[model samples]
Target: MKKALPATHTSMMRYAVLSISLIITTGPAVSSALPLMAKNFPNISLAMIDMIATVQQFTIMIFLLISGSIAKKIGIKPTISIGLIITGVAGIFPVFSQSFVAIFISRLLLGVGIGLFNSLAITVIDLLFTGNDKAQMLGNRSAMEQLGVCILNLVVGLLLLINWHMAFLIYALAFPIMIFFWRYVPEPRVNKESKETHQKINMPVVWLALLLFFLVMCSTAIIVQIPNIIVRGSLGSATTASLIISLNTLAGMAMGFLFGRIYKVVSDMTLPIGTFLMAMGAILIGMGGNLYIVSLGTILCGFSYPLAGTYAFNLLSKIAPQGSETLGNSVLLIGCNLGSFISPIGVRILAKISGNAFIGMFIVLLVVTGGILVFQWASKHVSKMKKV
Candidate 1:
């Protein structure tokens, strides 16, 4: 019938899963608090305002290529632990300050911390687990991260209704959990040569990473744009828009719980299925004329996001060289940040030209889905090769 996955698989996986989840929760807390942040710090320009998303991505993109090397030289545990400490401290700094310079410094430090964490976290999953275990581990990892973002965003939104500074406090909440993870999570096993050489970047991996970059760009655009689009487009009131966004979060949390279990049954169908659903969801959100339609689309969008995200990571792990765990994970961070970095500007420019964010987002989603399909084909063909 079926073989069993290892106990270490379940246990060690939790450490990365939990830490990444915390990291996601922290950043989105800022996003959810944007209006309040702007009110408190009025000098925040549209260009500087956009930096809320862009700075983090810019830092992650710049550091991702180097993080793999750092993880190899230092060790994943130390890298991640140090990142958490820095991230926690930087994240907490903004809660007390209204100075734009101080706030910007905090955001910059937060970005660096995330860069470190993102680089090591996914790669550690590749190192700690293998085969079917790897697939499931990645799925579970994606779920935890997605769930954290969705849930924490909701919490931040709720807390923002109370006070903006309260939302920043949420970043501190992660530190205790990370401390526990540091104590419990075992160090990864890397060979001396793998650590020394830093393995050549595979051409196929780079190609696939570019494809993932496009996919994530569309996803981040939707995630950031949906609430405002709904409110401004007259599809719903602010409260209704927030609730719809929260439903999207719930969908992600549900998908995270089910992703690995579903993968066991669907196998290779997962990525294609997820991409298709996600594309359909994005289109639904774009074309939707009312809140009901938008809400339905969001639920579908949520399900599709983490499913595809997890599949992307699983594919990266499969193709990555031995001891290239950090590198593989770095690719994911790079792809995701590249997507985030481009989305707001693209959406803003498109909105300026087209006169509607919905239409712009719709066009972008179609292009993104097309990219994912191309990568899906490439990855399948790559899977067929005896050597990557």
Candidate 2:
């Protein structure tokens, strides 16, 4: 007759810890692998190159609905465990890959893994916490993700100096994350009536979710492409690009910590302010030539992410039935994938018109800024309505 551990206890700790590992295991490796992957799979058409980045997001987007359902039906722990195993297996692929197809397929599998983990992790958090506790957990998850980017990107950059293959070694870090789930993380309590009572996702929530997805896509676009754009545009080498990217990570890490501190005072309005900061960052990155300006943009954008994510999570909690954050994550992952999928084509279009990829990236930033503002408005209006 042992009582269940409170959601505030085990579940929150589990998500915060896993969130760090998820980002560490995935984010930097993807960034580090890009240049090396291009070299290894030469003759990869731009279209195909775009697919490599986009495929993961696409798979996550497609599989998320199913993954969410599966998590509800089976268990969050199993879904998370399966995702880690898939990502781990996919990680070992680079060692064997010499062809475009091998790399391409591997990235898709990685997406499947990401989709599972992303969907389940959010759901687990949603199930475990309520009210402000939920908000803080989401905030911490955001911080952990930024931490992952900071630590992994820096490590990958240093490792890249050794050999590009060494970059893939980052995946090995995830092996321990699986063990962590088994040891400390307990199964998220499932709501028995949720399946029977939950309506089809509300229409308003769907629209907001889609818009949120687009914002995430924009963020991912910046994260995946910005470093290469800088290296190619101004810095002129992978090593230098790594330094610039590391600065971006440092900025994000600092902002993540700041958000963890300020989340209370900033409260819900953090979304608009965050979007404003992100817009400023994008403008600086797009328009400025001074490396310092670019660094400033990176920090501003980094801070914006957690702010936006926390705001979105709060909005989502209101719209979704019980355990909606998992669904919310699926939406977010899809947006990220769509952004990755769209970037190459967008670049192609920009390249044709402007004759340079960096300028194209700048243009993309402008477009993303417009989209971010639109969502900020929508989210705020939605929040006001909820209050009324």
Candidate 2, 1-388: lDDT as tens digits:
9998754486646554445344422533456457666776578765576455446765667677678777776778887888888877786576556667777788788777776787566666677766766676666666667677666766777877877666756666666777766566777766667655543466656666655654555465566666666676674466656666566666655665565456678665666666666667766766656667766776677667667656676567677656455666666555545655566565566568867544554555456557656866887899999999
Clashes of 1: 1
lDDT of 1 by residue, 1-388 (tens): 6776554555544664455655653565567577767787676686575566346656656667776666666777888877777778887786787677777778877877778777666677667777776676666666677666665776777877878777876677558757776766778877777767656658767866775776677676777777777888888788887777777767876787677788889887777677778767866777767888778878888788778777777777667776565676677667777766687776778679767665665666566667656876886889889475
Give the TM-scores of the predictions, in the order they appear: 0.83, 0.76
Candidate 2 stretches greater than 4 Å from native: 1-21, 24-54, 96-103, 154-166, 220-241, 286-289, 322-325, 344-388
Alpha carbon deviation, residue 118, candidate 2 (Å)? 0.8
User: CA lDDT of each candidate?
Assistant: 0.71, 0.64
The deviation in Å at residue 291 for candidate 2 is 3.6
By lDDT, the best candidate is 1
Q: How good is model 1 by TM-score?
A: 0.83
